[model samples]
Target: MIKVENLSYSFPQKDLYNSISFTLEEGEHCAFIGRNGSGKSTLIDIIMDPEKYIFEGKVEKESNCRIGYVSQFSQLDKIEETTVFQYIGEKFITLQNEIASICSEMETSSDIEPLLEKYQEALDAFAAINGDDFEKNINKNLNLANLNKCKDLRISELSGGEFKLIQVIKEMLNSPDLMIMDEPDVFLDFENLNSLKNLINSHKGTMLVITHNRYLLNHCFNKILHLENMELQEFEGSYIEYNFSLLQTKIEMQELAIADNEELERNEKLIEKLRDRATTDAEGARGKTLRVRVKIHERLEKRRIKAPFIDIKHPNFRFFIDNKIEETVALKVSDYSVSFDELLLENVNFEIKSNEKVAIIGPNGTGKTTLLREIFENNNPSIEINEAMEVAYLSQLQGETLKESNTIMEEFLEAGLKTYEDVTDYISDYGFEEDALNQKIGSLSGGEKNILQIAKVTASQGNFLLLDEPTSHLDTYSQIALEKALEEYKGAILMISHDFYTVVNCMDSVLIIEDKTIRKTNIKKFKKMIYASHFDKGYLETEQKKKLVETRIEKALKEADFITAKELSEELEELIKLL
Candidate 1:
């Protein structure tokens, strides 16, 4: 129950929002989406505390409306020793303890009236949160999330994904009127992501989630708030429906654009003819007609169609290599094992041939990142690399590849970029603005940092790439671009990813880690396994059909076969409804 009207904000570098407005109605589940560094999080901050930001907007909330928030990056360092149950029930426990202390003081104090008042206030606060059912509620939520086993586990014992879910449950248990989660699905594994989907679906109050995960986008939201090009579009429909509408609009706009261009060409020719006639005429009538035609041409130019949102600026990702190793195994892992306090992976083995694109996939805390890092370091006895192969790594933790204190230009320069001009020209293809070159790497958004990592890795011109969660913080557009880039790459790739779409679209095969061992599976089986585990039955088949139809539509449009394109678009609309 909040509304923003006529909102506009800007930083010194550029404008962020231009008179954007949207409303979060009661019980509405809205997905907030946009490109990286588009100020989605900053807008959230403004909504959370309007007084903290100086902007032109009216942010109004219902009186006494309670709100809960989960930030993009949440760390449990301070509460690492607390149990999951204790963490979730901290507020209930505090009120309970306070009430108990006051009652005990009332039993032996001369000022019993004051003690009694304090005890009543504590009880009221506790009851307001349904404290009588606190334990039961906690157990129910944990079971609902399939996290009952983690109730007694210390925070330090949980995986990052599990801990994030716990934080979400903690906020939900507070029973706030509205919840705002910023990229809550960032690093979650497939199973945990499914649990998150269920949680969002079952939520009774309003929610505004910022996420780029395809699974979540396809399954979770009833409304979509797309922020692009400093403008906001609020669509009251499923994400699939919204996407279909945008596609239909794009097609219509293209048709109109063609007609408009044709009209402009005709007008220009007529204007030129009139000008030529004026040069040859003895009277001023031809000159007057030419001036009138020139004004009409200018008006037509002003009314020319601008590209739609489908043409939003996205990084043009390209991966290059210095040399190719033909028909040879680029990397091999033989009887590899790694452990930290406990055995995480044992007897793991995999190989990547030259020009092969493979993905290493598993649940959280399954040693995917560790294995990728070890492979990149090339110090393990069990790991082997071709002598001529050059390696480059993109770590999930950006700090591993990028220096925090260095500016974007300085970082590239340190990476052997010859000059500032060279760095600027190179990063431009990766979607970095020229002004961004002077900003510290640490100040960039998560998606921006990930893009920088990819740019740096590509610049190395390595024939063997070890990528750890390369798609983690990227926007959907960049993710698609990366899939295309990886498909076209003429090098070996061993990537660690939890993104099902990326793995399915880009990789030829998968090395799955389970039960402390590694096994290989083809892309078809991987697709089936993922659908069976995380999605509805037959969903994959339908998606495949939809993808095929979409490709046909694109081909028809390119060949100027509007009839076939229209038929395919209608077919695609039906297919989207099935999804």
Candidate 2:
């Protein structure tokens, strides 16, 4: 639907691109992707003709084809004064104006034949863009984006995530022939992101999305536009193909360098032989020439430094932390609820037992962390907690239980842990090196700090653990290593995390805080609820729908995998009876 020919752009110091070109087919969903500093955003801006970016390219399209572009950066001021409802209505008004403009032009024309043709063409274009659903789609997608719930909420009051989603819904309603997005999944999680994928798949138009999340790339993209060396190339494969190509190219370059080094080595040996023959035998002038040749060979050798080949493949890691739990209740709350002024959660009941590794999962601002903090305060109404119980907390920002000037080793020692062999063993066990031990806790990576905190937990005498987004900043390897350690933990565990891999591995049961209620369900049952709820949402339908439904059925087919199989059965029975 959109084509760019001989696209070129550059800066004063560098040529960003030269003769880059691509074609977006009528229904192709293309992912415009590259590394962080690869000028992906600049290309989108160039295509959209936003501002005065220097470029030399000719973008041609089907005549009068409407294009809707949603960039990553939100323009708050552009729509802040408009209410969500009014903004939704504006989509219809814009289409109506286009229709009226065509009608008005037809009335002003003298030639009946040409004017009638022009009016018909304009009307066809309008219909082609599905102008009829402009308002219906606006309201439907707006509600999906939660703009309906925030009707009274001003644009200024919207959160960063809410604002991003709002604009996406607005752009979708425009029904452009082509939609362009950059970092479209920036603030979205698994559920909302799946919603976007469904939207893209259902739309008949073309799309070009630029994003950094590999998960999104793997799930949604059919083809990839890999940018390298100021050129454009069409590769017919998923994101995995691009990653493999990048790896192969790097390996090939390293091998070529090695071959070049061997050639230089052979030349140096020849020079040495020539020098020895001239000096020891006859030909005095030849000796001088050979000496000069040797010097040249030395300079050449100096220019080509032999570097050890490094193969660095960052493997994605997913950790499993679940170990069998002891059959004893570690904590319990009956009819639990907390209210700050007006917000109240009542009739909440849940239990955690020894040896059980559990997590409280929910969306942001859903008060998952608040529930954890309340436990430390003896479920107190207003009193804040500080060292209320023998628990360790890792907040979302990882801004808890750490201090400046405190070495990892010192912190471990201070935790009242068992005797250690200079703290290196403990740190290394969690995947940190000896060098990282002496470093102040302030500058450590999130993973490094997480490892240290895990070490602290092992060293301390605390039997019950309280963690908030404990795995938030950890890389896959560190997460898995910690998970392995938790598998053998003698005490109970409680965490609030959105890391799907980690949670799936470690959690025996789930404590879900959704829609202002707390519910306890075994991991298998919770997984069923997620799928059923998704199907209930209307995104997963047809074959995908059948697959999700079948998977849930198979899970139900299995006997209880956890200790609460009987309890879950009774819960299901009660739910069925109510229905």
Return the top candidate by lDDT: 1
TM-score of each: 0.96, 0.53
Encode model 1's per-residue lDDT on 1-579: one tens digit a residue: 899999999998879999999999999999999999999999999989999989997999999888899988988879999999999999999998898888788788998887888888888878877889999989988888899999999999999999989999989888888899999988888888888988898888899999999889999999999999889989999988888888777677777778889999999999888978899772689988988888998988988887537778999999988887786989889999999989999988788898888998888998889988888889999999999889999998899899999999999999999988999999999988798899998888999999999999999999988898899889999999999999999998999888889999989999988899999999999988888877688788899999999889778877767778788889999888888
lDDT of 1 at 274: 93
Candidate 2: segments with Cα more than 4 A from true spot: 1-23, 55-65, 73-86, 94-128, 135-166, 227-234, 244-360, 363-365, 368-511, 519-579
Cα lDDT for residue 56, candidate 2: 79
lDDT of each: 0.89, 0.62
The lDDT, on a scale of 0 to 1, for candidate 2 is: 0.62
List where candidate 1 sits over 4 angstroms from the true fold: 108-121, 279-284
Alpha-carbon lDDT of model 1? 0.89
Native-to-model Cα distance after best TM-score fit, residue 336 in candidate 2, in Å: 7.0
Taking all chains together, the TM-score of candidate 2 against the true structure is 0.53
